[model samples]
Target: MIKDIIANTTNIKLTVIIRRALQGVASNNNPYLTLILQDNTGIINARLWDVSATDIEALVAGQVVTISANSLLYNNELQLKINDYQVLSGKEAEKHYQNLVISAPINVEKEWKDLLKTVEDFDDAILKKVVLHLLKQNEKDFTTRPAAVRMHHNVRSGLLWHTATMLKTAKEIVKVYHDREINQDLLYAGVIMHDFGKIWELSSQLITNFTLQGNMQGHIVLGSEQIGLACRTLKINEQEPIILLLQHLVLASHGKYEFGSPVLPKVLEAEILHQLDNLDAKITIIDDALKPLNSGMATNRLLALEGRIFYKHEGEKKKK
Candidate 1:
């Protein structure tokens, strides 16, 4: 199974059909192929050598193809080396592999309505407008964008799920310190809009990838620029209330320089938002990493999640 290919060191002997070909150029070389193939278990990465000149042209993105690959470790991660592959252009491949992808099983419309209801609870009009505008701009992405490329919340509507959870947590904390005069408007806006820039920063295909903007300026600068445009178009007085309300203490959500935040969390609400966002993201990483099994032991090497090792926690046993 494809899951075994990712989990163990056994040579990949399974039959998988290529579902998508991600466009990428090797360092100082011509464009190579990064094929995303799928079996009943999950998707696996298959690297094709010299694909630029081969009949790989027929195997376009979303085209299923038969492949024979050897699994090996690259950069301490499992990767498949495609020895031979062919495009299955006829209707046979579709009937064989259409049910392999494990996508979101919940009702998308219900989740969206629930998200809107959560936002309506906030009593700040300016913050509400900012969020509404962002939602309007990415009506499709908010519901379809993955929270990450390959880590926690990397599913349909995953970004919205994470954002809604953070808002809920922020509300509870903000209520505890009622006298801080902490601008709930700004904090709420920042929490919702912080990663909204990623919608543009990432390519929203089946495989989420960093766009040119993401590779160059990264999400923080891109997000800040987007905020600037929104503020300008809406004619919000950004110098005083708008900047104070919209600006995050740490420019990036991570709260540190290395993680991409231009400014560290300094303001009261910005700091709080940073912590809340971090807490939610990390917990999600652990949750997703441990979701597959029910017992024994498993150590997940989460590169995108945190480049760290994670061990699943066994539930408590009943005392009879």
Candidate 2:
């Protein structure tokens, strides 16, 4: 698998799904295909040099292909130089497609049931009703969409997995501060709604892209707008304090103006949600980066992490 690859690894044949494929021009005016390849393990950037127009037409994101590549360390990142590739079709495509796509590691049905139970148990009746209403309105998409196109929790049903894990983490935090009078119910609702807009922002569950609205307004704004819709649907006044709080949580979840959400978190729950959101997302990002490195090896600078390199401390066999 990709995680075991090192600088000396060469001439490997890998069956990988193309997560992204872009054609670009080299310095010498030659055209090349820059492909982001993914498997169940992790993702890597690869280059198919000197490609013709037919090659560009033949490749696309989500297409499964078996390729012969020479692995090389470029700028501290392990990347592939594809010498050749063949697209998989029919039974072969079907077989690899099921096993290759990155997915949530939890049982979907169980998570859904548990999530609903937690929401149902909320002490704040109005908050519970609004949250349940929104979830019911978008259950199918919420349960199916990836949290992002190519970042944290960018896998099948990742939104649910991410939200559930964050909720679990928040629940523990609430317990820790049980004596502090923090409104645990508000925290729970805020956590779930923070990334709620991704379901609508992302174009599809498969072969995902940003919707026009998603690109224009972004998920934070898109999600905040939903609070208004939910209020109208639930016959709650938009001016209610809880409604205002939920909207703030949704809009300010990003935590910074440059990050997209211009409004900084004002309420305690919004602040808590922002912190947990970053913790969860960074944890996932680091996990994904470390998965493709050998123990004691360091990854290339990760753009998402502000060009920081991370090291893997233990290997699979060592852990065993």
Residue-wise C-alpha lDDT for candidate 1, range 200-249, written one tens digit per residue: 77777654678997888876677777776777778776674656546664
Alpha-carbon RMSD, candidate 1: 5.7
Highest TM-score: give the candidate number.
Answer: 2
Off by over 4 Å in 2: 1-11, 89-96, 314-320
Model 2 lDDT per residue over 1-320, tens place: 65566665779989988888999999999999999998887778899999998899888987989999989988767889999999988888988886787778888888888888888999888888989999888888888888998888888899999999999999999989888867888888888898999987998735678999899888888888887889898898889898788889989898999888879998888889999999999999988777766689887788989999888876445432
The TM-score of predicted model 1 comes to 0.71
Find the candidate with the highest lDDT and give its number: 2
User: Candidate 2's error at 79, in angstroms?
Assistant: 2.2
Evaluated at residue 193, the lDDT of candidate 1 is: 76
> What are the Cα lDDT values of the candidates?
0.69, 0.86
